[model samples]
Target: MLKAQETVLEIDLKALKHNFDHLKSRISSNTKFMAVVKAFAYGSDACEIANYLQKLPVDYFAVAFVHEGIQLREAGITKPILVLHPQAVNFNILIENCLEPSIYNVKILNEFIATASAEKLNDYPIHIKFNTGLNRLGFSENDVDTIISTVNESTSVKIESVFSHLAASEDLNEKDFTLNQIKKFKNITENMTKQMGYKPLLHMCNTSGILNYPEAHFDMVRSGIGLYGFGNSEKENKNFKPIGTLKTIISQIHAIEKGESVGYNRAYKTDTFLRTATLPIGHADGIGRQYGKGKGYVIINNQKAYILGNVCMDMIMVDVTNIDCKEGDEVIVFGPETTAENLAKTANTISYELITAISQRVKRLFIGN
Candidate 1:
């Protein structure tokens, strides 16, 4: 519990383990866990998180691209890394790294087989993504027969897992839709398993899905936000602890008279005398412009200080007239108690976007192995 002298994101591995064990408790003992460490582990440092989880010994690890998986491999991660959206060009390198690819459509599957063949690889691990309702990636249910035929024809690749994503597992209003998605995934898996003559591992639950729909746990479950300490609902949120704490220090303070403006474009002009604290963090640090102009706030001396104006590339001014904080006083942008989810709500965004949007330049410090 040391104070931050400069802007830093403190990553608590203890909280991460707590979140992991919490999510792990919800699934059956036989179920597997897939740790999603894409987008730099939701902007908290991917290699560190993946390395930690690799020791937690998650059954599988998933990333958004081939490069992410390669990074994990380079980090001494021996567990199977699934590349969720790999390109044809990277397939060769991906195979060389022993990174599995998620084959979403015909072109990707065929091309991956071709690449595997070129590398003289037989039965290369691959995952199949089905478009249940996300519509962002994955193949159609109708494409299953074609997928079966394609895989049947190729000894170059093997289906490691069959999975899909839940579109709105967090919103109870979309419960019916979410259930329909589960039904479709089960149906698809049934057909795929029957046709393939052997079952690949099956998974569909994200963090929210893990909590809300245990019946869809399939063979394994993926936890990304959950591992970062967010359960996506008010009730379930209490069960997890946010691992990354964003903190900065006040660089300086300003006394502004009425009609004086702060920051770019005069976005915030005080109508009365006030004090402002300029912080060394802004859009470039992942505190976006949308969070400026009173839309977001920071915690100072346990008091809420609203952002004063337009966020600059490397700085933000916050109104701190009533707070007893001064220059170099530690400021909390978001953490376990304040919670990124709450701060994100103020800016009309989700925790995923807020956390993942954090810039890479900010230093990261880890606590507890």
Candidate 2:
């Protein structure tokens, strides 16, 4: 465990390695691994996470946009990066940086072909995303012929891989839908390979897909949240260790009389004489205003201190009357003992939103490096 002076998001590299190893153990050695490092590695600092995983030597890396891949390149990442959703305006630069693009629609496929041709790039690697059921992005299942024919007409671009996304692989209730997605993916890949006379690397599994739907693990699998230590299932989560711990310290303490109000709008009125501790974190730092008014809590001296009132942008007050603690005492916003998943439940949300919402303004400390 580590201590925090101010608000900090501590990233434990040892816990990260533990998570990566656990995920790798679930897949075959022959199958390649692609680490998705988009959204600042799910808001934990992309360069740091990517650099660490690069040493573990994942076969590939994926980002939601070309700019993210560009940032990785600027940060000295040398491995292949797959831009999951690239815009036409950035396609030329994407090629210039040697970053692959996911061509999901006819327009993207056609524009990327033009970009590659303009650069005179031969066999430039490009992945094709097919819409199975997620319906967020990807070519329709019927687009296989269109995709293959378009690529066949051009030597500038080449299919590096064919992949899709799983809508709900974690919930067993969605098993039938997920299976149908897999079936469609299989059919799309078969058609793609038979027509092109070549087998591009195939992948589709996300973090949960890697765990619950091992049968769908194709030539390569992408792991995002799992690498950060959340399996999205209670039983599977125990197998992973969350790498980030949110921590802060008490800045001041106050003894309020009964009926005294605390925070913005005086949302919380004391029922009896009680002491409260003010902390240096609030909604702007990713805690959110909804967590105020006793909905969220922090651990002080191993005791829960429910938030007293409305959360300020840069501060929060907690009822710490019972705890034998003082100003500057260490507090656990959320950590191993009090997991983010548990804390998020108080807000009617999931761990993903909570963890990723951590404001970059908060200092980040890396341990066990």
Candidate 3:
């Protein structure tokens, strides 16, 4: 361990376990949990996170790409992994690793089926994603017949689960839309299962859906953000603990007078006698340049320090004026006190984007209870 001495993402596995246990408390004994570990486990460390969760015995794991699953497998993660959006080109690699693929369209389904048949594979698990409301990457409801036909003809493949994505399950304003998606998903699953003469596991709820719409918990729930310690709302029980803390140290401090500029392009001019500190983080490390120029901030000595100017690729200057701070002092980029959700609000984006946007170059230190 680096002993919290540098720009690091401190991951609280205790909080993660607590979050998982809390979310699991909402469902019954039958509803399995699938932890989503895509995007480097939300910019923390997928292999480490996966390894930890495997010890927790989560029912399954999910990744966004085939290579991500492969990465986990190489890291000694033996749990069943579902590849959310696998490319057809990597079908062989996916099969070689015993990784399941999510088939969203008939073309990919046919291609996978052919690959399985050619390899003489038996019992290859595959999930079908339907576009209930999130039309980003899923089969249309109208394609139920085509989906059923494809499943019926595929002898080498075994249907594992049928799932969908929720676009706005976190917002109560979109309740009607989420309900509509739930109804459509249920209807499609029922019709398809009846037509195909086999009932695969059905799942549709993301973290928000699992929290806001418990009725749609289905057979399994795919949780990403909730597992990372963010609930749909702080009002939603307020029990979900944040699992990641981004901490950095002040590299340098400067005392400036009025009219003195700071950072790239001299975007910010000190209004009064002030003290500023440069953080060892910026857009290149996923702080994002849009958050610069006084728009974003960091917390030092329990005080908020506004960004002094444009966020550089490797550094950001903060107006630590009037605060008791010094070089090598710990600075909070985002954590329990300065949450990623709050930071996202500052950047006019969502927490999902904020967490996922964190670059891989940042060191991540994992901790347990």
TM-scores across all candidates?
0.98, 0.98, 0.96
lDDT of 3: 0.88
- All candidates: CA RMSD in angstroms? 1.0, 1.0, 1.6
Comparing 2 with 3 on TM-score, the higher-scoring candidate is 2
lDDT of 3 by residue, 1-369 (tens): 243578999999898899889989988888999999999998878999899888887999999999999999999999899999999999999999989999998899899999999999887999999999887999998998987777677679888899999899988998999999999999999998888777899999999888889999989998998988788687963778778898899999998988898887888887788888988898888988889887888888889999878999999999887899789999888886678888888879877788888788888888774
lDDT of 2 by residue, 1-369 (tens): 666788999999999999999989999999999999998898789999999999988989999999999999999899999999899999878977889999989998999898888888899999999889988999998888888889999999889999999999998999999999999999989988999998999999999999988899999999999988889988998999989899999999999999899998999998899999999998899999888999989999899999988999999999988899988899998887698988999989988899889999998888898
Compared with the true structure, all predictions reach lDDT values of 0.93, 0.92, 0.88
Specify the poorest-scoring 10-residue window by lDDT in model 1.
112-121
- The candidate that achieves the highest lDDT relative to the unseen native structure: 1
Once superposed on the true structure, which residue ranges of model 3 sit more than 4 Å away at CA?
1-3
Give per-residue CA lDDT, model 1, range 1-369, as digits (tens). 669999999999999999999999999999999999999999999999988988877998989998888888888889988888899988878878988888899998888888888888888888999999999999999999999999999898889899999999989899999999999999999999999999899999999999999999989999999999999888999999999999999999999999999988898888999999999998999999999899899999999999988999999999999999889999999998999998999999999999998999999999987
- Go through the candidates in order and give the clash count of each: 0, 0, 0
Give Cα distance to truth, residue 106, candidate 1, Å.
Answer: 0.8
- Which regions of candidate 1 are displaced past 4 Å? none
